[model samples]
Target: MIENLWKNIKKKEFSSIYLLYGSEAFLINETKQLVIQEAVDLDEEDFNLSSYDLEETAIEVALEDAETIPFLGERKVVLLHNPFFLTSEKTKSKVEHNVKKLEAYIKEPSPYTILVFVGNYEKLDERKKITKELKKNASILEAKKLTETELKNWMRQRASYNRVEMDEAALETMLQLAGTNLFLLTSEVDKMALYVQDSKLITKEIVEELVAKSLEQNIFSLVDKIITRKIDEALRIYYDLLKQNEEPLKILAIITNQFRLIYQVKGLAKTGYGQQQIASVLKVHPFRVKLAAGQAQKFTEEQLMKCISLFAEADYQMKTGGLPKNMIIEMILFQLNHDLRK
Candidate 1:
């Protein structure tokens, strides 16, 4: 697992060749930074650290650098970025790579150098000999996006790393408020951890107070309020969004998206699809599917379809200047509230 590999790296357990591949750019970047930070000193970076874009640079060039002795340091760190040849996808670059040289290097990598291949592609061409060789010989990390459970655990780990304790409610609220981006979550967690340093505890209240809500998250809250028959609260959220200069049509778009997800989640659940399966089919985060499932329980298919249709009409009116955009969204909110109340 990536976590174990990270632990090993932190302990200064160096590997000759490392393969970091996957769609999650954050994890891949994090692993690269961690390796670089641990492998080389600040002063030695000038001579010991090298990064080559495989799309533009030939494989033999990077390999030769990797084979070169470290300058004024015991170890050398080489980063190979965008190794597109490892994947089946063809790049626009006409630079031809020497795959045989890379394959040979993988077999007998330089012990004094740390060769890191950063493949941002989602998947490698597994059938290729170079990929197979790296898999067999190198320390590998497939930095795919974590699932909901993994995300929660990662949050807890981050908090713990900062010597703070986060309650379950705080964790869920953090996810809801911050969304699933690791970079944002990491920042928020560090901020909150510092805030609760005295008590060393992060509660839901603290999270709500400090975490900045994205526009989509505000729309989600607006929908939640509407579902619970709290039109006043929903309108307040809409007004707050407008105060922040959010475009009416953009807010409407997210509202429409939230209802559509609820509708889809409701329908999928009826047909025996679990949250993860539904997330896969819809190409969204599983945590989003979970939230939508809860909201779906309060909504019937007809009600959701009606809500969607109202947003569609509001969208058309807003675009054609039939009504003021703010009034259009307000009217849609009232209409949805009135319909849901029935």
Candidate 2:
């Protein structure tokens, strides 16, 4: 975890080589920024900090740069970005990398240099000799997506850092309102911190009043309203969405997505999967799983399945039929409400 890595960096513990590979852009960028802040002095950055895109230059050239001594500092940081050679994905870079050169450098790296290989890829080709050698020798940081527990812990820590206190309810509401996107959550946290700067306590009311819901989230709310038989409120939300110039087809697509998620959640829950486990299995954010689980509780398995089929049909008709999109969606919502009332 980056927190563990940060602990090492805090104690001035340095690694000769760091292989950071991940799909999470926020985590990768934050890791790189923190490393630079900890390792290189601002005044000597021009001379001590070096970055290369492997798509433009070869790995051997970056290795050569890593071998050099720092100009004005005790150590230099070399950032090798987009090392597509590590992944199985084919690259359009005209430059040819010497994997042998990189393998050799890994054997005996410079003590005064922090050689960081940054690949914006999910996984490295494990069968490759060069990939194996780098993993064996360097400090590897995989910025995988965080689980529900991990994200909450992160939020707690972030709240402490920002000098604000967020209650459990407020945090949960924030997660649902912003979804489980780290980048979006981070931005919302900053805004909430400023809003609660005086009182320093982020309450549920504050969260609900301040956090802006994504369109998908609003659709989820619409579903909740429908399930609770508040059809008037649900239609109000739908009208407000239309007022924002949101396409009815787009809205229908999201509604279909919600029904499908609820159906999936119901099936998974029947098999005794908890929210976090279901989230992992479904490759969705934990916050989303939690919300889906709640919605799933309001319907029988049969009802959820019927909802999915109805929306699937709506999706097909919207794409092919000449019917107005608003009417199609209204019919779907009305029929869903009617079905549940039975």
Candidate 3:
């Protein structure tokens, strides 16, 4: 997709029709708008511009509207957003009726009319017959979630493109702390870029102080204590996070997710699965999974199961409001670590 995206964006070779679907609606919509603005002008909108919401209108009505020629122009453009209306079961009759009509029209679509479809936030089922037909007949771009490492690498490229310089460590720290919320991450990076206008290099201090849950130090400290079975030290770190307004449920959730990954690595290593298979299943980089799998071999399955169940109980208690949240978690840390040590 990356290689194709590069070649597809060159205007001279661009496809006239496009179906853009994805979770990242903001970026997708921007790309759609750019295509439209380049295709027509504001003064020509009366003859050229038409937009519809699928929830409100039928496919036949949109097709009829699109096929109508301008009273006074050379070209027409139809913009359909959330055309899921075209695919509804209740509207299936109408959709089939219109799709055939559309295919007929598409075969000899207007030299003056450009049809563009947008489903900004949700995806159209690519596995469906209609989706395949659309793909074969027109251009399609599916914007989806970037992998963790891809997002991290992208941050560096994005910062460079935005005329910002970020230290490699600071960039990596943001990736670990922030996961993959591109909108928020881009905003934070942009703000830091502007703040460091004179200095030119965005430092770790700037990022740590500004970004929420800058976990470079705190997480390392927490991970260290947990790994070494230092219950008291881990408790202090956990409580520090709590006092700073981190939710108890979120902490339990993150640790639980981490443990599950470790569990998978352990199981795969025991069975002699290679690093690539483990990474794909875990959705982590092969090297990281390999390193974790090697480290996982050092811990007994008993320790892994003990940590998992402890977190699970902590989660259950928090969700049910069954006990004093902090105390329950604090006790869990001690009992589990104490058991591991003995």
Per-prediction TM-score, please?
0.94, 0.89, 0.73
lDDT winner between 1 and 2, please give it: 1
Can you write out model 3's per-residue Cα lDDT over 1-342, one digit (the tens) per residue? 643643455453445466777776655665677666666677887667888766566566777876787655656668877767334323332333356766665566655666777875444656656566776777776776665566667677767766878887888777655545677777778777777778878778888777775443355456557677786799888989888887777766766766677788999877877877888777665645644565576578888887888888788888788787777777777777777677
TM-score for predicted model 2 compared with the true structure:
0.89
> All models: lDDT?
0.91, 0.87, 0.68
Q: What digit string (tens of lDDT, one per residue) describes model 1 on residues 1-342?
A: 888899999999989989999878889889999999999999999999999998899989999999998978899999999998889998898899999988888878898999999988888999998889988999999987789789889999999999998999999999899899899999999999999989999999999999999888898999999999999999999999999999999999999999999999999999999998999899888999999999999988999998999889888898888778999888887888888888
Instruction: Tell me the alpha-carbon RMSD of every candidate.
Output: 1.8, 2.4, 4.9
- The residue pairs found clashing in candidate 2 are none
**Residue 176: error of model 1 in Å?**
1.9
lDDT per residue for candidate 2 within 1-342, as digits (tens), equals 677887898777989999998877788888888889999989999999999998998888888889998889899999999988888998778998888878888999998999988987988999899889989998888988876677777777788889998899988888778877788888888888899999998899998999999999899999999999888889999999999999998998888888888888889889888887888888887778878888888899889888888988888888897788888888888888899999
Candidate 3: clashing pairs of residues:
none
lDDT: worst 10-residue window of model 2: 146-155
Worst-scoring 10-residue span by lDDT in model 1: 331-340
Lowest-lDDT window of 10 residues in candidate 3? 88-97
The global Cα lDDT (0 to 1) of model 1 is 0.91
User: TM-score: which candidate is best?
Assistant: 1
- For lDDT, the strongest prediction is 1
Candidate 2 residues lying further than 4 Å off, grouped into runs, are 88-95, 272-277
